[model samples]
Target: MSHSRVNNQPAGQHGMVVAPGGGGNRNAQNMPVDADGRDWSNGLCGCCSSCGTCICATVLPCVVYGKNKHRYQHLDQQGTPEPSPGCCSGSCVAHGIFAACGLGFIFQMVNRGHVRHRYNIKGSGCGDCCTSFWCSPCQLVQESREIELEEQSFGTGRY
Candidate 1:
């Protein structure tokens, strides 16, 4: 069976007819029609905005680390390092250092979680199953550590 480009379509509905340069198909079900009545299949719509993409990228990390105490502490203490000339040097200076070093470490740890891929069972037997990889910041890191241990035991350098 051929996969359809349309995200969602009712049963027995004709799929969007895709052509070069995003031509073809004028049906509302296949393409989202805008207020101006322009056909989105003709490339009238603008690409996703930078802010939208950033939100998409940041959301996973936020969801994963938002509840963690360490992540909260790191964010709460950001950019306070190295006291100003007139500022007091006690807690302020300490906080500044913590923000600088702590934020970097925390970001690194969170980013690592954001990039690691996960797999899911696709079919009945191992031979029939296909692996799908997804990057999810919410994934437990201990699972990754366990996978690493298994790989080491099998003498696999990386997988």
Candidate 2:
């Protein structure tokens, strides 16, 4: 049995591998709070904190959901790709469709989980589902604010 090696190293494409403590790992950065995790930057009921977002969410929830999801996905990334396919295409459309069928909460709930995970915000999947289901408008606004705050911290200069 013979094994091929490169300079006595394993032979394979390792370009995507990020060496530990070698830098370039964004997720390795410090989380905001202690090991118990941190509370959401904005309270669940703090809808009035951003009136325009609340109004937009109330009037056009699909658009708001799409926009929030888009922003959240790109929160820590660099560069301006596009807004989000869902914003102008599938995302908003599916949200509208699900809303009409009374299942819009499911879509937003998944995104809510992503936001919580990204920020290390303390909350359960059940809680996120309930929040998305019960107070959708407020959830949308809250997520919008959270993503906005993160973007501000990153200094991307686009809101």
Candidate 3:
């Protein structure tokens, strides 16, 4: 049998090598990474950070979930200082329905996303889902702490 060269390309030209953090597709200069992005002020498992929040989340998650939505909406409205929503707000009822079906994680995940977006917190949708699904009460309290901190900083004065 006769030997013949089947491939002509050189081995050295297989691919391009780029340095880490070299403004590649992920961190392109024009993309402008948000320096303002921040970690959650309260850790997911740091329920002890606020005893009241922890208790409320564990005892009445629906209430916490509803209030989180309520407070986030008020914050979105930019200092309107809406009256405090009752514990049985629409969000609470929705949360109760979802929780009854053992699917409250879905609602909590979305709520967590809203919290993340509103505060420019450093987290992804998947992460929020996992955190919310795995430990809902902890996630609720964590979100509660973050929002409460923001409210305080903005002088909302409604804990």
Residue 70 CA error for candidate 1 (Å)?
23
Each prediction's TM-score against the native?
Answer: 0.17, 0.72, 0.72
Off by over 4 Å in 2: 1-32, 76-87
Model 3 has an lDDT value of 0.70
Candidate 1 — what's its lDDT?
Answer: 0.28
> Candidate 1, after superposition: displacement of residue 17 in Å?
31
After the best TM-score superposition of candidate 3, give how far the Cα of residue 15 lies from its true spot, in angstroms.
35
Superposed on all Cα atoms, the candidates' RMSDs to the truth, in angstroms, are 22.0, 7.7, 15.3
Estimate, for each residue in 45-140, the C-alpha lDDT of model 2 and write its tens digit.
999989988998898899999988766555434322223335444788899999999999999999998877766677889998999999999999
Estimate candidate 2's RMSD in Å.
7.7
Q: Which residue pairs show collisions in model 2?
A: 86-91
lDDT (10s digit) by residue, model 1, range 19-91: 2222112242234423322222212122123334233333433322332223223222331111212223233
Candidate 3 lDDT over 29-92, as tens digits, reads 1222255456666677799878887898888889999988887777566444336666778999
Give residue 127's lDDT in candidate 1 (0 to 100): 18
Clashing pairs in 1: 80-96, 81-96
